[model samples]
Target: MSDLWLFSFMDDELREKIKIQSEQTKAVVYSKRTCLRHNFLIATSKSYTENSILAYVDNTEMRSAVKDIQVYHMGTDILVKWQINEVPCKSDTFRVQLLDYKYQQFAETQAKDTSTVLFNNTSPEGIYHVRISWDVYSTVRNLYTHAVGLENVNHGVPAVPHVTDLGNARARVRWTTNPHCTPDLIHVHFREPSSIGLLKVIPGTDETTVITGMKQCIQYAIQLGFSYTTGKEYLSDPAYMTFLSDGTFHNAPKLSFDQNGSLLVQWLLRPGCIVNQTVVTVETNDQPAKEYNVTGDQPLARLNDLEPCAFHTVYVTIQYKNGNVERTNSSEIHSFTKEIGLTKIKTYIVDDVLLAHWESTQNCQALGYRVDLMNPTTGQTKAYLTGEMKYRVSIGECVKSCQLLVSAISVDTMVPVTTLIDVRPERVPAQPRPPFVRRDGPALFVWWTEPNLDLTIQSYKLFVNDSKKMIRDFEVKQPRRSILLNNIEENVVYSLNLRAINESGESQPSLSVQYKWNG
Candidate 1:
């Protein structure tokens, strides 16, 4: 008959013990063990229990633990693989989870036979944590947890190295890699005249690697090596480094006009980058572009005899000994040259507005013109800027005689080229002829004629008085020569007068006429 028996296991290294019960004629026990040196198993019958060391069978295989983990970067995705040293049993299950920088799980999945898991859309700039767990004999056990970033994993190809020419048969190379990479060693390889040469450098705060003893004005091949933390060495694609300068200029060329209105070109060069020659170009709307070549030592060039008041664009370019050419960024400038004085300027009066116009005799390409009208009597001036040929201002009765100045202005240069003018109305309407009066029904009529046609007559003024003071007044617009007087009393004496009006002022009153109203 089979009897119930008790089995116990003890880990001497960890000093931990566990017990299980079984009922069988031939007792067998698989006790879990930790990674330690010594472990003992004890079996007991109904009467007594026996203690002995587990010598033949290894129980540590049943205990699951994370062994090796490999992480790879795939752009915005991360791939993780966890490998276990021991063969997995049919009942083994695996769980994979992706966590954020704060250890919050965003995605999770479980499988029975998968060692690799992929998380997509995890941008390269993000910090992510990965967790893996497996079931060992119905017990959940965590395998590994790791933090991944761009600097941590050799996800893709390493960044390309940048080489700069430092002149005098010397060159400088610079590059950067993932910060967490912690490369075992950095190697720079080049083929020398007789054999292959390698330079070993340690990655740290220093970023620049300088290589000397190279031929000037020649090209050479270069390669870099990096050893991953997993003890695997990686080599980068071959890159070319040349000692000849490539006309690398950091600052754009500056273009300006001198005090004498001449075109001046100025530029600057980086400390180590040298060029064989520089070319300056000038272009205009009415003419083709012109180029000027200057030696590399000369930083400035002057161009004289440019068209007056012309719009021009100037730019600079540099060339290397190897025929490589490069233009400076934002090196071009567009501007207008200074202008000459305006000519054939004339001023006149139209109603209440003062009209001033000029002739573009010099064909100046100016942005516009400025007209200024100053009242000498009141000491007040009004200014106007316009692109048209003519400018107008209201003078009316406020300004009888004023001074005018017309100027040509360039948008690039605010300097004015002006011509002075004295503004005065050519003539005012002459005095009107003597007036006559007529009676029709109960109203009296007063009439007059304008004797001068040389000046424009704005209106006609009529005045009536009853022997002592003015009684009624009327203003008749142009083309009307008569006005009718109402409310006439019987047998009363009245005096009538008329005047002509123009832009200048009212003309002297016409000789008075005597009249009488009879009922």
Candidate 2:
């Protein structure tokens, strides 16, 4: 008792090439397995407002540019808005034949995305939507206003954008501005789902970005059409086929970037349909990724040794003549502050000291080694200036020292280290534990005697009163260290001391401890 077959019906040379009156044409009944057959739209115009007949105009005569819906007009009098997928073979009423550019003959009905933005042209000059066939001739006209109803707005304000800051090659975006859009026309579209076609654009507003890639999974989107202003995206539309990354649906392609923290993604291709031998038709879902001129124009590429702040994603793909391919992705996620200023190197206590940078296991962790010798006696290891830094180390006499080796890169991972500079100097650390006066309560219970540690000791420096303004600190990572100065505003008596560090420096202070809180 269930066969299902209902086409709503509309035929008669497509209803005399429909130029008005679809006789209250309406459709909103789907269950025949959801419906959407080859899609169609024909009736070209209709409006009344004061009582009945609200809107109409149908299109998708189908020619293939992907997202078909071109040049429709209406200053006032026919407000259009279309959406009909398979319903007229006999009666659901859907037909078209609207024209105006001198070929004349206008007014069909049922079509939309907010049609009729303006065009009853009394004189203000502007109104068009020509396209026909069925003895009507004309086929293309465009004017419609309010900037063409903004096409329905968002004109392309960076569509399908998403960027909670994804990293390891790049991806970042946030959008919602494009209605006749200016300040940087837009046209950005990316793909990675049965790929082929559009996949890049941001030449303006730059919108806090980062979209380079090692690839994990992708399919992007953005398209309205832009070519001026700050972000210079060319022009192309199919609603911008979006898929920012993550998981996706298809609103216009929504997958917008996301990957910071443990940073991931390493893509090549995979979705479906790939027959490369019989003539190479490998469209693993549209296309986006696989076009590397390597460095044709080259702006940046080679963050050597990598690992200072960590996090990266770089890409550059360009190909065109007819085959069409354009790409540009770079993601460091911006947060690279390292400009304190001052860099003057001169080392004679050693030979050939060359340190280069540009690595991406997320910025190569600081990049180490610094040596300045001459001044040591003990076991020849009394040290003058030295720093190893991994877990920690910086034996010093202080002529100046900094052992860099930062971190951020994650996937296409990397880590290479070499620290060798022996200006000959070592050993001379071991002298702590002299102050330990406990009085507790009204405050004054300082203690010290901890040293001979093995790395990781961020704090433990307490020098009070002497115009040093009174200081205190502690983060010994471990060990039961102590420091309690409490309510001491008394006819006071303070002069506490203690110093000890093991990341290689600091240790000379532990002989003063005079406590007297005679309130």
Candidate 3:
């Protein structure tokens, strides 16, 4: 067995043991080797082998001489309250002292027949120390101390609140806090006559709030209270108000979209009641709602820059007398924006046909795609609509060089994505099959096979030149691949070459053919 002695027990446990009602058993173990004591409190019904407890032993003194000590700052006074664990001797009065954070006493008091004391006009942040006996010789050390800060003190109760009746089973409440107390919560206690009351709690920062779900045309008793950060509570006197709930909205809001896609909303208010302000809330899919506040006289609000291809919900809230809010009867107005735009577009050519393709966007309600081809040469534009993702146009002479504008067409919108493509053969007509030449005394006949009848080729050209320089040239149109030259010199070795020509400039000269003309 360990050498142990139970020197003292906590106040509550000691009281329970004295009354023979202690449902817990406490065991104290003293380690004579280490000069430390370990204490444990276990359920009286449970065996010591069934409970687990790890206790650290220290050589410190026993529990403080006082229990249930609380420190508070109310208004300009610092208040300390405590309970003694044992009855004091008549000569051993209570001593209360106010100390700084460093535990240096600044104010001290001796009182008999009192368990609490107040220090008037003291500084804000400090600690309070209380112990038995006023003389230093009678006390060994301070028994209990508590830290208090003036920042969270409760000064006084909140002023009586003002209540207003709003139609549709609602009432607005407004209140003001005392000068020095900053509460953490505001409680609005309201009760209908002869019925159980309900309490609504709101944040301390709110001076105005609304309570709903009450019976109309009934009188209610309303009161306000505050709860501070220091766990202190204060309540105000009750005030009476009758809920009339007679006001109502007369007209529903009208909604429309302008040409620029801005939402135009118009609403009306009750005729006789004076209004404070109007608030319009616009909510869109997957986005935070936006609010617009306007004067009471203005009934219209235009919301701009909304998401395209999304649904929007609009509503109006009216603020009237004594911060009361009333919502319109036909509140919700639903509308949709235009479809989204098209994605990246790509253009390619295959065998005299121009093909334009693009990606279809998600969440877009497009009926079809519109492909518009504009001829840069003739300045003519042709529009074609197709439901497929790709569109093909035959590369003709008129549209060899054109700009294509592709747009996704929906019920209400058509936004275009444009790209330029040159269908005209960029490589000069494949060097025409070696030109054939025959000379007849100062004249020559040249002919060659047409190169695949390319649409990019407008015509052909033949060059006749002497060994020194080019002498003459002849032009030939399509379908007449041969040209006759009459102005060639006789007995001269001439170099003859041919080339193809179109809107995209000229092709490289074909292989030169030598023909000596001797007449």
Candidate 4:
């Protein structure tokens, strides 16, 4: 009755035994008419005869090939789905293989369901081949699908852009392209330092582009984007860079004279600029111009061993490594004449005040004169500026001689003609008014009205007497009309005295004042 029974003609006993075994094992066999024409049979029992015909049925006859396989792209991922007209069993598993255009397997996955998702992380911008297979009865049968193109997938944002060959007014920008999708056009966006919120666009087919007409020493932000013909676009993050201009010597050197009468020259170095060398020329009216070479890194230069009384002109020139040369724009010709000591310097004292007079040489026009007097005994010095040739100064008491410095400044050259003199005054100044004293806690504040005089009062002296009859003296310098004595005894009455001193001698002591500390 069954296909297994058809083999009974070779052995009747075997047939009966198989019938009894089939009944006991609860097994049912399909006849030739019931099985599909392409089916193959497989033996399930091991005890069957070796010569017994065991038909092996291929699993393809029971399993159905996957049909209508479709692939769709969602963002950066690829979704695959298929249908099975007939399933051999509910527990059957399906294997899906993704291949590139070159027929090389790119991705393979197994799923128990009908649909799965794949990523395009490694695949390029082209069509892909999809093969899906299922196992039935230990045999695998696959289904081939049409090519799935990823041309319309969104590539998201591109890579950050980079700047190269940055110059004063030009720069080059480049970016990376997406391997999964090709763009119809690429656009570069940039913003200048002064033009925030305003973007400039450059369209090109290549990944690299050059931008021009940029400002020097300014920072710029650049970004790139890819656009498709279907109006989809993706923008990348911004990249920042600064542009540096060529070096130019635009600042002039400043000139001054130090205390030793040496000429000092200083200049500033501009940003993003380099200097190769500098040439300094000194020209005097009676001598030929002298040149000095200096390195670019050195910003200061000193000129020494020059005549003190001659007028000199200074010129500076700068040369860059790029074969560019520039001169000081502000007329590098500057006049520098050293100070010539004063002529016919004389000094005399009258009424404790010292009078000094001098005359400048006839060769130069004078702008003014400055006289400085120093008391060697007190190590104190004073200076006075006047347009006239005469100056009156004050010397303190018990001072026998003072050092004087008289300088006549030239109006055109600004050089001082200086002289040193020593003199002693014979007169003394009048006494000053008594000081008004006040006590605040343990401190004593003394105030006085300065004496009206034609000459300068160099200093003042304040004498204090405590309750114990101990005396202390303090000297007050010029420009200060008051003095405060701290650490005085509280609730004690203290006596104070004030006197004025000048270049000639000290004045008579003023009337005394007393104050009591209340705290």
Q: Write the per-residue lDDT of candidate 4 for residues 177-275, one digit (tens) a residue.
A: 655444556777777655753233444455677887775545578887765533455677888765555423356677777756678877665455467
Of 2 and 3, which scores higher on TM-score? 3
Structural similarity to truth (TM-score) of each candidate: 0.34, 0.20, 0.30, 0.35
lDDT of 2 by residue, 366-458 (tens): 343333222233223322222232222233443333233332222443223323233221222344666677677766777666556644444
lDDT of 1 by residue, 256-355 (tens): 8776556788877544455788888877766988888886567799887566546677777877555446566544444442346436766556455677
Compose the digit string of candidate 3's lDDT tens values, residues 125-232: 533343333321232333444544324354455777888778667878888765434556778888776585656566655688888876643457888877654455
Best-performing candidate as measured by lDDT: 1
Candidate 1 residue-wise lDDT at 308: 55
Question: Which one wins by TM-score: 3 or 4?
Answer: 4
Q: Give the worst 10-residue stretch by lDDT in candidate 4.
A: 8-17
Model 4, CA-based lDDT: 0.62
In candidate 4, stretches whose alpha carbon ends up further than 4 angstroms from where it belongs are: 1-140, 143-160, 165-170, 176-187, 191-207, 212-218, 225-237, 242-492, 501-519
What local lDDT score does residue 416 receive in model 2, on the 0 to 100 scale? 32
Ranking of candidates on TM-score, top first: 4, 1, 3, 2
